[model samples]
Every structure is written in structure tokens, then in C-alpha cells.
Target: MQHFICTGGCDGESSTPGVCQAEDCKKEGEALTPCNCEDGLHGEVVEKKDEDED
Candidate 1:
């Protein structure tokens, strides 16, 4: 699964990548990053290998 998350120290996340909606992020205009890792487990995008890819 894939999703978007905010890196501006806020809890903002969306199905599509976009600006963070947190009050603080509104000022900084933080952009959401696409990732597949567990929430907060990674600051950068993480991709999981599909078993079928082997």
C-alpha cells in the first residue's frame, strides 16, 4: 500500500501527495511525501518488495 505523509512534524497525511494541512505546516507549506513504510518509522520514502517480484 502507498500513501502520503507530511514531514513538517505534524500529523497530516493524505491519499494523494499535497501540502500539509496542519496549522504549523500552513505557514511553511510542507509537501507530503509518498511512502509505504509504517507511519513515523521513516522520514524518507520507503518501498516494500513484493513477494511476486522474487
Candidate 2:
């Protein structure tokens, strides 16, 4: 599985890595992409992958 996390005001996390999607910083609609966990209100997005997906 996958999900998004707000990285704007976040401190560095000691977890799986995620890329920058600064474009995802808009909060008025559904996520720009499917299964994309985005908090547009904040300029950040992270993908939380399931360990079982392998």
C-alpha cells in the first residue's frame, strides 16, 4: 500500500524515503494522482509503502 505525508513543516524522518512533489501543494481538490497521499494545504507529500507489498 501507499500513502502521502506532509513534508513542508516536517523535520527529517528516519524512515523510508520520499521524493519532492512541490506541485502537490494545493489543497482544493482530490490528490493530483491516485493512491497519492497528499496534504495540499501544506507543501509536502510522502509515499508510505507497505512492507508486505513485496
Candidate 3:
């Protein structure tokens, strides 16, 4: 499983972060394919590993 990230502003870090669909979003409606497309304030390659794997 995977999720998008915002390396600029969000840094993929938020209390409720995943994919920002807001107007301030770097890559609105962007999918996590061909990853690392720096969309404004975003970079979609941050992987959140599963706890099960740890």
C-alpha cells in the first residue's frame, strides 16, 4: 500500500495528511504513479511503511 506526499510545505506531514484536494494543493487530483513528479509543494515518493513489516 502507498500514499502521496508533499515535500515542500506539507513535507507529507500533517495531523490529517494523505492527499490534499484543497486549492492550496501542489498536485491536485494527482495520482501516485511515475512518482516524484514535483507538483508545486509536493513530491510523491514518501513511503509510510506498514507496522506489520516492522
Q: Give Cα-based local distance difference scores for all models.
A: 0.63, 0.35, 0.41
Of the two candidates 2 and 3, the one with more favorable lDDT, higher being better, is 3
Question: For each candidate, C-alpha RMSD in Å?
Answer: 11.2, 13.1, 12.4
Distance (Å) between predicted and true CA of 6, model 1? 0.4
> Candidate 2 deviates by what RMSD?
13.1
Task: List model 2 lDDT by residue over 1-54, tens digit each.
Answer: 334443332323222335434544432222232233244332234445335422
Q: How good is model 1 by TM-score?
A: 0.55
Worst 10 residues of 1 by lDDT: 45-54
lDDT, residue 26, candidate 1: 33
How displaced is residue 50 in candidate 1, in Å?
A: 33
Steric clashes per prediction: 0, 1, 0
lDDT of 2 at 38: 41
- Once fitted onto the true fold, the runs of candidate 1 whose alpha carbons sit more than 4 angstroms away are 38-54
